[model samples]
Structures are given as C-alpha cells and as structure tokens.
Target: MSASVPRLLVVGGNGFLGSAICRLAVGKGWDVSSMSSSGKPYATPAGHTPAWAPRVKWHAASAFSPDSYSTLIGESTAVVHTLGILLEDVGYKQSVKSGDVFGLVKSFASSLSGGDGNPLKSEEERKRGYEGMNKDSALTVLDTLISTTPPTSTQTRPFVYISAADAFRPVVPRRYIETKRQAEIEIMRKCDEHPEAGVRPTFIRPGLMYHPHIRPLTTLPAFLVDLSAKLSTASGLPNPFASKSPLHGALESLRTYPLHVDHVAAAVLKCIEEGRGGVVEVPEMRDWAGLGSKKKAEVGLQGQ
Candidate 1:
C-alpha cells in the first residue's frame, strides 16, 4: 500500500494529538486523511475553521466499522490509531470540555480497582473501559488493515499505535496501562503471525501529552506534574504533595516528564518514515524530534 506521494491515514484525527499529527503531517507534505466519529475538527472559539482543515480529507466513521472507511485506510502507505480512553465514567471530550480537572482525577482514583468489569467482555463493547478502547479498538482496526489487502510479504507497510508511557504511580487504573500493553502485544503478535501481511507494527508510547492551543487546561497541571516527576527521577523522592492529596500526587508522577503533543506527533511521523516495528519510549520520542523533554516540559509549563 506504499505510495509515491506518501499518503497517511490517521484514525481519530479530530482529536488533540490526532489534530497535531494531521497538521504537522500536512505541513511536511504528506497526503493526509483523517477519520473521526465527528468527521471534522472542533471549531475555534470564534466559530471559524482552521486554514489547515482544508488540506485533510475528513471522514466520519468508526474504526470498528472499517467497511465505511477502508478505501481511505487502504490508500495510505502508513496508518495511525490514536483513539483511546483514560477513564470509564466520562468521555474524553466531555472531561476536557467541562473543565473539571479535579473531578476527572477523582474519577480515575475511583476506578483504580478495575471492579467495573472486564472492558474486553465483547467486541461490541468497545467503549466500556480501558480494554475496549485502548486494546480492542486497535486490534479491530489492524484486522481491517490486514483483511483489506492481500499480503505481500515484501511490501512492508507500517502501522503505528499510540500507546501510553504508563502511570509511574497508581493514579490511573491499572487497566489503563495494562490495556495499552495488551494492544502492543496483540499488535506485534498479529503482525508477526502474518508476516506475509506486510504490516510492520510500531508502538509510540507518549506520556502526559499537553498542548497550549488545543487543550490549555492540561498545561498548568503538566507544569506541576513535570516538577514532581523530575524530583522523583533525580532523588527518588516520593510525591511531596502526597500528604495533602495522595491521588493527585500520584497523577503528577504519572510520567517522569510531560510531552508537548506536537513533539509526539512529530515522533509518530518519524516512526512512520522509518517503517520499523518496535516500542519507542518517551525519551526516544523527544530525541527523534530533536527536542529534549525538559525543554518541551518548560514550554508546556509556560503554556507557549
């Protein structure tokens, strides 16, 4: 499915990280197409469309329903799955739009035990929890990718899965990281089990990605989160704020450093360009984009 012009298909492209990937990829001259449930990017506060919106072919469809968007998927030399959920109680968009950070954090705290039931209870239950959104959605799309085209063992198409770096502390549900790891394992198994399928799978695990323009609400928390994460790394100190609030402290230590969304987006393109299959960690993601995590951490801190 490789093309001379380097076409890219971004599943869930209307999202924050997804939108960054689409915008960056378009600037780099890739023929980019985005598919989201909404089929379009969010309008600015002024109710105007972005200039880059016209450059991308937006499709409204679910990744689970490949029949609706397979032609778009198949035409691309590379594909990215950027769809996943953080909490079970509220939708990602709902959490962000409501501007209730503390409430979202409390929701994560409540669901840590995974008592809600197995998210992978069935293929149809793809949004119930971590397993369904993070793991099954990815597997479903890969199934579509493999089944859509005949295997050419030598073709070497690349599929990038947006996995997480995981919570260093127990802030998020254990299933959140577990489900993402499950996706990586299953993706690797599928690609290896079908070498003739010509799909090389890669996992880019980013941590606490923040952006100023898209999700300004995440920036302040990332600043404080980064400070704690750095302290933990440097001195092996526990979260200083633990006595005040253990859950929020753990959330801050979720990653050793926060990442700018655009940097992660750039790293995804770097992974796709290489067409190699493997796990890429946070530090490597920063390096590939020629930016250090510390620098980007401050940028996010400044809300720049």
Candidate 2:
C-alpha cells in the first residue's frame, strides 16, 4: 500500500459488516489493519470472492481493553467500531466458537460491571452485557485512540460506530436499543466537549441487513417485516427475530428497514472517506453506500 494512503483500523473486522468494509477499503487502496480477539480476517480464493485478505493486516485484541491494540492504533487515520449484539446467548457463543472475536471483550467488561464472573444468566446480567459491550466499548476505543494516538494533523481522526436502527424495534429487548443510544449519547458528548481530542465520532445506525442472494427473494416478506418493525417501536413487542432457523432468520432479516449487508459496509467507508461525523440514519445509509441518485430516490420512497 502507498504511504500516502490512509490507514484504517476496524474492530470486529471479522464479522459480517466489518469484513465488507475491509474488502472495500482494500479496493480503495487504503492501508487497512483489522483488530479482533480472533486475529483472523475472512479469506477465499481470489477468483471465488473479492481478494481483500492479501491487503489487510490483522491483529488479535479485545475491543474492551485498549491496551490490547493501543500501540497499533496510533498510526491509523480512522477506526470503525462495529461492535454490538442483537441479543445475548447461544448464537453469541457460536460466534465465539467460530473465532469471531465479536463481543468477547465487551462480555468481560459486562461481567465486571455486574460484579459477577459468571456468564450472563439474568436480566441484570444481560443489561450489564449491553451496557459494557454496546455502550462503554465505543467510548473505550475512542478514549484509547485520543489518549494514545494523537492525530498526524489538525484534522480530526474519524471513528465510525455501528449502532442499530432497530433500537426501537418492538420484538427486541429495550436494553439493546437503550444501551446503543447511551453509547451514541456519551460518544457525541465527548466529541462535542473535546474538539482537540483528535477524534470525530460518527454513529451509523443500520437497518436489518441481509446478503443480496436472499434479499431479492424476500421482497414481500421484507415489506411485512418493515410494517411489523414500525409497529414494534410503539407496541414494544418482544423481538423474536433472532431465530436460529435459517429460513426464519433469513426472512426476519427483512424487517426493520432492511439494507443489504454490502450497503451497510459501504456506508462506513464513505463516512471515513468524506470525513463526515454524527448520526447516519437509514435514509442516509444508501446514499453513503453509493447507491447513486436513482437508487437513492427509490430508497427515499421506502421512507427508511
């Protein structure tokens, strides 16, 4: 990679959205570094998939503990925290088993917050998990970068935070959305208060995301999900969207203002490239995803 190119550090880079960002960033010629507890980025044959693994530098680290990757963070021009959990349980365990490193650090912090060493077993435990992983982790990364890694210039370093659009979704627990909201509140407050900290925190709230292959098949189901998702906000319905059934989950992914996984990933890169910061809701997601004027117009009609 060219030295003039910007360097990016993606926490949770092995996950669904983070992997996409790395692929796109590599294509853009940015020097990319991915940090996760697992320390491995997804890879496939160059012809079989987009060849991004060759270009990215992967590191093992916990998002909750700044010290794990603090030294590597100093030289990055941007950092994206795509850390979150829809719900906590067996699915989360499976992710860990796959070496996802998605929320391990946050889980540890959550445990500490609850004054318990045991895994999440109660509502209170779950709340602490969301608080530590979803809210505090973002602040921790920003704090680590600001304190340890001064920007090379006066320009604020971009920090992209991936929050959820379904924070108000009825079927899901309120704690999930509330914790994410808390994260946004604390992060934006820090940005507002400390302009010289060299951190520009950008929050991207993505709608339900799905792979393109399955998306086209779910247009009507997705529409239904969207309607239900809207009512969910006011009704405060319990979110059952986390079903392990492949068919159920695939269809459920359409609800809550669905976007393709690639679109979500593209939005993050666009934020960093444009040096934009602040909240990016569903409507703005496509624009940043580079859907162009025509697609953007269609997205607007969806009223996401």
Candidate 3:
C-alpha cells in the first residue's frame, strides 16, 4: 500500500511561522522535517530548546546554497518556503555575499528585537537586496525542486510561498512589495514553462500574525489594533486597515489586521493536504484555521 503520511519540508522550520507550521503539520500526521542554516530551533541564551524541537528532523541548509538542500527537496512530497528578511543593511548584505549565510539573518533578527527598521537607504539598494534575498532565494528553492524531483514521481508536490498582505498595502515600501510580486511572478512563470512538471505553486498572502505567548510583545498591540478597527466601523469612518488607505495601514492592523500565527500554519497545512494551488488570502487562511472568516474576499485564488 502507498504511504499514508506526507513527507513535508519546511525551509524555515525553526522560525516563528515555520515552527508553527512544523507543529501543526506534525499534528496533522505529516512526516515533517525543518531546514535552517543553524540546523536547530532558536534557543534562549540559557540554551533551552523550544518544546517543539524534538518533533521535527532538523536539517542544516542555506536557502542561498541550493546544493545543500537538493537531496532533501527531492525526497519531499511538498516544500514550504517561509524564508525572507524584513531588513537589509549594506554591511550585512556584503557579508551574505561573502558566503556568510547566517549573517544577514542574525542582523535582521536582531533588528526585530526592538521594532521594524529599514536600513536600505536608496530605492536601488532596496531593490537589489529584496530581489536577492526574497526573490532569488525563493527561485533557488524552486530550481532545486525542479532539478531534484523526478518527473515520473506521481505524488502531487505543492510549493507554498509565504507571501504577505503588506505586499499590497500602500503604506509599505514599493520596492519591498515589488520584490514579493516578482517572486510570485517567477513561480507562475515556472509553472507556465513546465506545465507537465506537476509542481503546484501556491502563494499564501497572510496579514500581520502574532502568537500570544510566542510573541507576547505584540499581544497588547494586536488587542489595541482590533479595538481601533471596531471603533472605525462604529464611527462610520473609512476602515483604517483597508489596503487602499494611504495612511493608518499599520494602525488599522490592530483591529482588522493581525491573525493568530497558528492560523497561518493551519492554512498552509490545509493547502498541502488538499493539494490546492493558487493564492490564499488572509480571510481564507483564517477560515481554514476554524477561526471563522471575518471577510469573504479572496485576492487571487487560481487553480491548475
């Protein structure tokens, strides 16, 4: 008989969203393995591992180096690309260019210790950094899958890209949004180029997501955001969280924006379980999580 458990590889398994995916996938009976350059979950300074660390097979691999993960990609039933950075500094980007795969990640993660910051000063620099780390790295993962997975394999392998709702928000930098747009374009380009390859490409555009205990810092802010959203409706004013809003995009996120991190994880798992390909917007993601859909809109839900 055919194997019942699906083999899944999460490229950023130890990260916030990735770890959630790993845990949720495990609960769904998927044989899940996580890949990261560190080859382990992030631990406290005291060296205490995360509680979910033992549930996954951790593999050391860098998204920049496709060779390091070709074997794992070939053997997986589905692969999720959850790797990307929100900040980029010239010095750190230079270090990453010199084969320091973890340098950019380390610096980016450090910046998040406080709040969001953009170090790429110029549009040119932002474009280059976003394309390299976000767009190119994702394409590398797809390249590895295309080269490693045999065409004869009958299993329907879905490639899930963890894109963001901010990609469409006007408050976000245009370069950042365009970078993610480019990545989605590349995924579709590859699908069109290899129609018979059987590699399904899916893009999950999630809104701001926060975990209660996992990221306690955002819990209160999420609460306030949610409150502000409700007040906006009561006041009969324009929705602050609307994508078309030139301002208050970040502010509106408090009420109508942030989703639970587990919701994103569950949405991804559902996408894989059903072998569905296309864009899954925030509302559908929340629906898949059984949180009940707050909105009925779907941005770009396509099918093969």
Q: How many backbone clashes does candidate 2 have?
A: 4
Predicted candidate 1 versus true structure: per-residue lDDT over 193-235, tens digit per residue: 8877788899988778887656777888789878876666677
Q: lDDT per residue, candidate 3, 15-74, as tens digits?
A: 778888998888877788999888976553335786766878999998878889888888
Better-scoring candidate (TM-score), 2 or 3? 3
Q: In candidate 3, residue 216 scores what lDDT?
A: 56
- Number of clashes recorded per candidate: 0, 4, 4
Model 2 worst lDDT run, 10 consecutive residues? 212-221
| lDDT head-to-head 2 vs 3, winner | 3
Q: Which pairs clash (backbone N, Cα, C closer than 3 Å) in model 2?
A: 170-237, 171-238, 171-239, 172-239
Off by over 4 Å in 3: 1-3, 42-47, 89-128, 167-172, 232-256, 294-304
What would the C-alpha RMSD of candidate 3 be, to one decimal place?
Answer: 7.5
lDDT of 3 at 287: 68
Full ranking by TM-score:
1, 3, 2
